[model samples]
Each structure stands twice: as structure tokens, then as C-alpha cells.
Target: MKVLFCGDIVGRSGRESVTRNIPRLRQELGLDFVVVNGENAAAGFGITAKICAELHGAGVDCITTGNHVWDQRDIIPYIAQDKRLLRPINFPPGTPGWGASQYETARGQKVVVVNVMCRLFMDPLDDPFRTVDAEIAKYTLGRSAHFILIDVHGEATSEKQSMGHHLDGRVSAVLGTHSHIPTADSWVLPGGTAYQTDVGMCGDYDSVIGMKKEGAVLRFIKKVPGDRLAPAEGEGTMCAALVETDDKSGLAKAVRPIRIGGRLPPAG
Candidate 1:
């Protein structure tokens, strides 16, 4: 299975870049499934129903969220109905929306998409490791879940990296998100799970993780909120990780970092 996982979609730039490139990308990469983190999809905040539907129509099979899953109150109703959008699995029970979803590829293959958020420097939620472990167990019965894609959303690379190792062989791919900077450590693990420390942001590369550079700089330098930061209007890149998983064993065969457009250097 050719699965492409894109990192957080920032603001307008991210959405525009995705709308412009994803259709072509799907065709060029021969992607069977596509998952994108929509935590930052709406103006660098949370995602909404409209945006989620738009992205889905644009070829993204599933959308995942992190700590910012509920930033937009309007999503509450939409999330309840949209099975394609997933919140963090670690979120306590009774939380709105699901943490994982199952989709059928064009060829009728069962693909499972799971989203988990790390506790380190994140919300005080349930243990992601335990939650995902249980979730995996539920799906692994008789290999019901053929292809598994895990989106580990967090701030700390160590936390993300640890989750990847924890899920190593059991999953098809474990890609990190939320840092908004693509890591070079895209490789298939010893156990065959594709792993990357971060998949980066699909937005303006000239700014700080897709936010306006001047505002981000001001916040860092002054340590005070003067004005709301907006998405930068610069050349953007669609940062993602491409992974190919075996059909029979459901293990990753190859992994590669993908960067197109923007100021970021090309990924080899």
C-alpha cells in the first residue's frame, strides 16, 4: 500500500498549497491512502467541518488532530458525524469524536488510521502508549486491520520517537507531527515499521513553522502578546512522508521524506 502522511496544515498558505498540489501528488505518487494532520489547518488553530470536507474532497482520505482538535467550536457537530476525522486516542472517554478510523482503499484493502498525542509537554490526557496499544489489539484480531498508520502528535521529539519504537513492528508506519519541521530520520525500522521524527508543516517555509515571522519573532523576543499572529504569505511546501507497506504482512517496505515548493531544501 502506498500511504502518504502529511504534517500539520497551517493557515491559508497550507490549505492553498495542499489544494494545488495534493491532487497531482496523489496521481504521481500512486497513493492508495492519504492522511493529513488538520490540527493547524484553520488559520493555525483547529480544524472546522468546512475545511475538513474540503480537504477530503481534495483527495485526503483521513484527517487527524492533536491538542488543538477542538479549538473551533463549530467542529463539535461535524466531528460527531465525520468518521474520517480523528482526534487523539489518548483523550479521555466521553470526549467528542473518535481517535481512530478504518477506511477501505480503492482495491478494497482495509486500512486503519490511528492518531495519538504524547503526554510530554502536552495536555494531561490518558496514557497514549496504553491507549494505542489497546486500540491496536482490538484491530489486530485475525489481522483485521491490514494497513496501519499512526500519527504521533507531540512537541518533544523524544516522545514521538519513543512511540515509534513502541509501535515498531506492529504498525505499518509511525510518523511524527506537531513540530512543523521535517526530520531527516525517515527510514524503515528494524522491525519494518516506517518511522520519522517529524513530517514537518505543509505551509510557509519562510516563517516560523508557518506563522508570520515578525509576529513569531516578537513573541519570542518580547515574551508578550502584542498582536495575533497570522499565516505567512510566502512560498510554501507540502511536507510529508511517503511509506510503502507490504500487503501480506502489513509492514513498511520503504520510507522517504517529501518536500515540494517553498524555501526548504529538497529531500533526497
Candidate 2:
């Protein structure tokens, strides 16, 4: 099973980059399933219904989010009905949308996509390790699913890396997000699971983690709250991971990061 996971979409530049390159990537890369983190798609806040539709139309199979999943008040009811859109599974019970969803490719291959936010330096949530254990127990790769993809959304790299090892042989891939900066450690674990510390943001790298440089610098220098953070308007670089998992054991056969159009150059 070949799958691609895009990092957080920061703003209009990120959306435009996805809109422009996803279709081509889908075909050129021979991707069977595509997952995108849309938490910061709307002005560097939360996602919206319209943005979700655009992403779906752009060949995204499932959209995952982190703490900012509810940034847009309008998404409250919409998330409840959209199975493709997911919030963190660690969210309290009765959360609007699901945290895990199963999707099928045109070839009749089943893929399970799950999102979990870590508790370290992040909003209070259920123990992610246990939460993922329960979710992985429901379906094993190669039997119930051709591929299982987990997006570890959090602030600490230590926590995300821990999740990757915890589900090493049990799932297909454990790709990290939420840091908005691509890391260099893209490799398949000893247990055959694909892992990356972060896939990075699909937005401009010229700014401070996708926000405008001037405003971000001002806030840091003065140690005072300044204008709200805004997404950089320059052309974005799409940072994502393309993984090919084994068909029999559902383990990762090959993994590489795909970065294009902005500051990052061929991080794969």
C-alpha cells in the first residue's frame, strides 16, 4: 500500500500549494491513500467546511487535525457529520468528530487512519499511548487493513518518537506533525513501521513557522503580546511523507519525505 501524509496546511499559500501539486503527486507518485493535517488551514487557526471540501476535491482521502481542530466555531456541527474530517482521538468522549476512520482505495484495499495528540506540553488529554493501543487493537495490518496510518500531533518530539516505537510492528506508519518543521530522520523502524519526527508545514518557510516574520520577531523581542499571528503569503513548500508499506506484513518497505517549491530542497 502506498500512502502520502501531508503536514499542517498553514494558510492560503499552503492550500494553494496542495491544490496545485496534489493531483500531480497523486498520479506521479502512485499514491493509494492521502492524508493531510488541516488544523491551521484557515488563517493559521482552525479548518473550515469549505477548506475541507477543497482538500477532498484535491484528492485527500482523510483530513486530520490537532489542538486547533476546533479553532473555527462554524466547524462544530460540520465535523460531526463529516467522517473524513477527524479531531484528536484523545479528546474527551462525545467529541464532535471521530478520531479514527477507515477508507478504501479504488483497488478495494482498506486503510485505517488515526490521529492522536500527545499530552506532553500539550493540552490535557487521555494517555496517547493507551489510546493508540486500543485503536490499534481493533485492526491489525495485513489482515483487517492493508495499511494503518497514525498521525502523532503534538509539541514534543520525544513524545511523538515514543508513539512511533510503541506501535512499531503493530501498524504501518507513525508520521509526526504539529511542529511545522521537517526533520531529517525519515526511515523505516526495525519493526518495519515508517517513522518521521515531523513532515513539516505546507507553507512558506521564509516566516516564523508560517507566520509573518515581522510580527513574530516583534513579539519575541519585546516579550509582549503583539498582533495576532498570520500565515505568510509567499509561495509555500509542500512537505509530506510518501510511504510504501508491504502487502503481506503491512510493514513499511520504503519511506521518503517530499518537499518542494519553497526553502526546503529535496529533504527526502
> What lDDT tens digits, residue by residue, belong to model 1 across residues 1-268?
8988989999888888787878998898898988999999889989988898899889999999998888899998889888899999888889888999888989888999999998888888899999999888877721687789999999999998898899989999999999998888999999889999999999998898889998889887896767887888787798999998888889988999888888888663
Global lDDT of each candidate: 0.88, 0.93
For residues 19-113, write the lDDT of model 2, one tens digit per residue: 88889998998889999999999999999999999999999999999999988999999999999999999899988889998989998999999
The prediction achieving the highest TM-score against the true structure is 2
Q: Can you give the TM-score per candidate against the true fold?
A: 0.97, 0.98
How well does candidate 2 match the true structure in TM-score terms? 0.98
Candidate 2 shows a clash count of 0
lDDT of 1 at 5: 90
Show the colliding residue pairs in model 2. Answer: none
* TM-score attained by model 1: 0.97
